[model samples]
Target chain A: MLAIVVLLVIWWVAYWLKLQPPHLLPSPLDVWGTFTKLLTNGAVWEAVTKSLQRAFLGFAISVVLGTLLGLALAQFTLFRRAFGPLITGLQILPSIAWVPAAILWFSISTEAMLFVVILGATPSIANGLASGIAQMPSIYPRVGKMLGATGFDAIRFVILPAALPGYIAGLRQGWAFAWRSLMAAELIAYAPALGIGLGQVLQQGRELVDMPMVMTAIILILFVGILVELCIFAPLERYVLKQRGLAGAKR
Target chain B: MSESTIVPDSSPRAVAERSGLHVPESLIDAATAVSINRVSKSFGNDLNPDGSLRAPVLKEISLDVRQGEFVCLLGASGCGKSTLLNLIAGLDSPTQGTIETPGGRTALMFQESALFPWLTAGDNIKLALRLADVPKAEWNDEIERLLELVHLGGQGSKRIHELSGGMRQRVALARALAQRSKILLMDEPFAALDAITRDVLHEELSRIWQEQDLTIIFVTHNVREAVRLGQRVMLMSSRPGTFVRQWDVDVTGERRIEAPEIAALASEITTDLRREIRRHAK
Candidate 1:
């Protein structure tokens, strides 16, 4: 994109002019050299695989928990009145804020990392489903009852399908928060037992004051985020919107 | 076609009847399908000084829908016609008194198709069939039969969005039929359609009504639509809606939406409806 071109040009200018110092602003080529060296040393693959595996596991748990929470909050009036505000409050609280407590309780382990990721992603996912259920057209429930669908049957067949589009969008947002929280956990809770992940790579670069290595890690993080958006969220949303015929229902 | 005769698949239904598929012997009347005895509905809590409820929508409404009868409830915009229909459909209960549809559950068709977009036409009917306790093995055949009844045969595979507006309504009708309930309540089911489509659907509905032996309670503001379809049209007054008048439509020939007899009766009903509306202005 033109924005990438502009960014590359600015970086080249800063590096060429030695705006700060040779140590601070490395050329794009230098960053590329460091990226290739990491790839050849197998650190890039090792870090990517470990980080992504954690992301997958954490996200899977959050989705299951979030969906249950969303349904409970949406269906049971007593449950919603009790826990809805509390869950929403949890959403606004930053995942990074949990790092210290998590480190203490989990002692710089995978548990510490997963604890933060699950906490970060679950609320957004739940809220997504809650909002989706709330925004469902009134006709669905009424019709569901007319056809003898009561309680759980109504929730499963009518409410769930009607809330699907919103649920999917929630899933995408949950994934975003999940990835970010995982990275933050990695950066803060780096240790030998945790293995060499992207966050650990960035932390190592920071300790060594290696500019090119830091840039490579940041680019990889952004790359994964963009890749998920393009490969998963975009197509899923398009399919749902198209199949539902967004314009047909009044909403 | 009489109840005593054994149709080809009557054995299963016979067994189902014994197993309480239809309403029990004591509760069900052979002639009447739905019995609404002095039923009333209201919205909101009782905040009045005398402890009367706030905003009564239907006031002491009474009606009996006989087996295979086609009755239409005609009224102005603010009338509790839809609220009454909802009460009858069991979507909502009467705030006072009771409504008894002793012929098992009823199916209601809304103005919009209200079909699940994620489902194909067949699947929509399948849900209704499933809820109605139709056997799983017979689902494919039942769906085909119902779709065919609505003149939508072999089109069950199509997505709801792929169908035309008229087709969607037909699919909705098929879904309602799939419920296998003796009663079908429609609340302005074709109000959103074009004139031509509406007219065509009316004819199809009349044919389906007789063919399927359904007792229908159709609600609408359109008087001509009521005249064109109902065997008996009940005109309701708005604002605490109650039946003000009733006309037994007995045209001796084919009834069209714009037939002279229909127009004449509709105009008479319109005059009364206008008077009811005028009363609100004061």
Candidate 2:
């Protein structure tokens, strides 16, 4: 509610200041009108579904490989010594930076877009899992062993649950990376057969000087990211925290 | 709080009578639950340039705990009492000696409850039961029985955070029991509780120890707590900890922390413990 009020205030302030023409910086009312128009057109829905498909597929691949890599890095000293620094270095490399290499490797294809998303997301997920395992309380393992949870059983029952918070944090970061990388790929790849995605829609709006269409695409992109975070990850994280008695309602 | 027999009869006559036709295979298995001989432990970084070993935490510590004996290891803070207990618990190995526990498995209880916060009270015990190899079919009944043993029969479903400190420790005790081990090692399990709660748990521990026929090696810095619970108290010296003294408190019935005999024994031990500390000052 407060966020909506803040957005309204920013919009009114920009209009009052006369900072830019309506064609470049569309008014809040104009953006809203565009939103309604796109909602009825069916084209916006197609782009949204396609963007979501790409993001989900790339994020899924990143999670599997990243979790495996993170576990190995955390558990084995040799593996950590060899690749830990390099993995952390990868996290700071921008998702946009991968577009050029991905285009060269896969040649303006969906596979190229996927390559960029996975590359962008995997390090953050892996780092999250590794740090989570590293931060586990020593007492957890002691109690686990005393109770006869050994090796794989210990990892499954004790280590994994203990590391859930960190892993979830990693997942959140990975999703952000995948989303950004997907948009960057779609904007740059220019594959005619890839169909309409939000990134492509925004790029086409730029080419045609359709400011309302660009603004609509931007709003949808932001809305989708925030929606998934609130609807999926937030609830999942809250449930885990609540189960551990770590989450409490404010007094 | 039914006033059942909280003390076991260790009398020769009782032993002779029990050694008759009713001798079970478990009874004939081992006379001692834990045997530690000349045990010493040291910790230091091996990569240190000087290559000199750090002073041993515990040294030349030899002790034997008979089956069903409640023994307390009493010492000052740095006496390595905890190190000795860990060695006996098999959490760590002794640097210079051997620890033998012929008694199948041992369960250890820490000062903190250490219950998994994610689990309900009942689920905590169930995890222990699972690890102890209790069959899945028997878990419900076994969980109920163990909760009842800790006097927490119907409170199993409560989350760990909802329980009071005393109740949490009781749940910890129940989890330990679910291990179904021959020996229970308690590392000052009640040291953190308030006086009233500690007194109550002392009684609870005494009753449970007798009923379960468990051999317990309890480590503590509190003299009264040691005297209140143990059949025998062994004092350890600090700095390369070694057994300095042992006292057998010959109380036959349930013992209280405030009992005259307990206070007297505690004072004597305290005097010896202070002297050991003074020796370290020089």
Best by DockQ: 2
Q: Which residue pairs come into collision in candidate 1?
A: none
Q: TM-score of chain B, per candidate?
A: 0.86, 0.86
DockQ (Cα-based) per candidate?
0.67, 0.68
Q: lDDT for every model?
A: 0.86, 0.85
Q: What DockQ does predicted model 1 obtain?
A: 0.67
- In CAPRI terms, model 2 is classed as medium
Worst 10 residues of 2 chain B by lDDT: B1-10
Provide the clashing-pair count of each candidate structure. Answer: 0, 0
lDDT of 1 at A161: 85
Residue lDDT tens for model 2, B1-282: 111111223222343364332433454354877877777788863322574336778867777677988889998998899888888878888887788997768998887768887789999999999988899999999999988988899999999989999999999999999999979999889888899998888898898998998999999999888998897788888887888666667687858766788888889888887888898989
| Candidate 2 Cα errors over 4 Å, as ranges | A1-22, B1-30, B45-54
